[model samples]
Target: MEVVKELKVPIDYLFDVFEQSIQSDILAQTGKKLNENEFTGFEYVKDFSKGNQATIQIEKYERNRAYYYSTHTDKNKISVRYDVHSLDEETSKLHYSEEIISNGFLQKMNDALVGLVWGFLKKKRFKEMLNQIEQSYTE
Candidate 1:
C-alpha cells in the first residue's frame, strides 16, 4: 500500500514533526531515549493487545528525507517507509508505503482476505493523522 500527500508545512518542519513523533514512540515503548544519530539500526519490541508482539528495527534513516523500518512477528514481516520531498519553501510531498509478507502458506492465504479490510482501515486512519498534522501547522 502507498499514499502521497502534499502538506502545507515546510519540509524542515514536517521532518522535525516526523522525527519527534518517532522518538517519542520509541521512548514510550522501550523506555530508552535516543538521539537522531542512534536511530539507524535501533531495535525494539512493540507489544499489542492479546500478547501479540513484534520486533521493530530501523533499516534506513535520512534526516528530512526518508525513514524506513521493518517489523518482524511470528506471522508476518512488514516494512514501512516515509519519504519527504520539498516542493517549495513552505510545502512538502510525503510518500508513504507499506509492504507485508506472510510467514507461511496458510498465513498468506488468510492475510489476503484480512489484509484487504485491515489495510483500508489503516490507510484511512493514517491519512487522518497526517491531515491532523497538516492542520496543526496551519493553525
Candidate 2:
C-alpha cells in the first residue's frame, strides 16, 4: 500500500516529522527503555553501513530518502519506505510505500484484512501528524 501526502511546509520539516514518528515507534514497539542512539534491538545505519537484522532496523537514510523494516519473523514482516521530493523551498511531496507479508494461508488472509483496517487508521494518523506539525511550527 502507498500513500502520498503533499505538505505546505518545507521538505526539511517533513523529514523532521518523519524521523520523530519512526523513532517514537521504535520505542513503542520495542517496549524497551533506552536513549535514541541506544537500543536493545533497533539499529540505525546511516550512510555506509548495511543492515543485517531481521527485525526492526533502519535500512538506510539520507537527506531525502529513508527505508525502514520491521518483522516479527520471516512469516510476518512489513517495510515502509519514504522518498521525499521538493517542489520548492516551501513545498514537498512525500511518497510512502508499505508492504505487509504474512505466511500461511490463514495468516495471509488475516494480514490482508488487518492491512485494510490499518490503512484507514494510518490516514487518520497522518492527518493528525500534519496538523501537529503545523501547530508546532506556529507556536
Candidate 3:
C-alpha cells in the first residue's frame, strides 16, 4: 500500500516543527501511535552516511528532510520518507509517501482499510502540524 499526503506551511517554521515532532522522545503530535501488539515504537537507526543506505527512523535532522524507521514487534521495518519543498522562504510544501509491501490478499485489505483510516489520520495530522507551525512562528 502506498499513501501520500501534502501540506502547505511556512518553510523555516515547518522545518522546525518537523525537527521537533520527530524527536526520539516526542510522540507524534498527531497522536497516531502504533499498537504495541504490532509495533512498540520507532527509533532512529541509520542515516545518510558517506556512502550507504539510509535508515528510516529519524535520529536527527540536519538539512530539511527527516527519515523515520518504524519497527514492528515482529521485526518488520518500514521507511517513512518526508520531503519538504520550499515554495518560498515563508511558504513550503510537505510531501510524505510510504510504501507498504504485503501479500496480495493483505495488500488489497490494506488498500481498503487504509483508504478510510489514512485519509482521516493524515489530514488531521497535517492540519495540526500546520497549526503548530503557524503558532510557533506567529507567537
> Best by lDDT, which number?
1
TM-score of 3: 0.51
Model 2 stretches astray by more than 4 angstroms: 21-54
The Cα error of candidate 2 at residue 66, in Å, is: 3.2
Q: Per-residue alpha-carbon lDDT of model 3 for 1-139, expressed as tens digits?
A: 3334344456666655554545423343324443323222344334335644323444334345544444322223444556666766666666565555444676657766876888778767766765666666777
Candidate 1 lDDT over residue span 55-103, tens digit each: 9999988887999999999999999999999999989999999988999
Q: Over 4 Å off in model 3, which ranges? A: 1-10, 24-56, 59-62, 65-68, 102-118
Each model's TM-score, in the order given?
0.93, 0.67, 0.51
Off by over 4 Å in 1: none
Comparing candidate 1 with candidate 3, which one achieves the higher TM-score? 1
Given candidate 1, what's the lDDT at residue 108?
96
Name the weakest run of 10 consecutive residues (lDDT summed) in model 1: 13-22
Ranking by lDDT: 1, 2, 3
- Clash count of each predicted structure: 0, 0, 4
Model 3 scores a C-alpha lDDT of 0.51
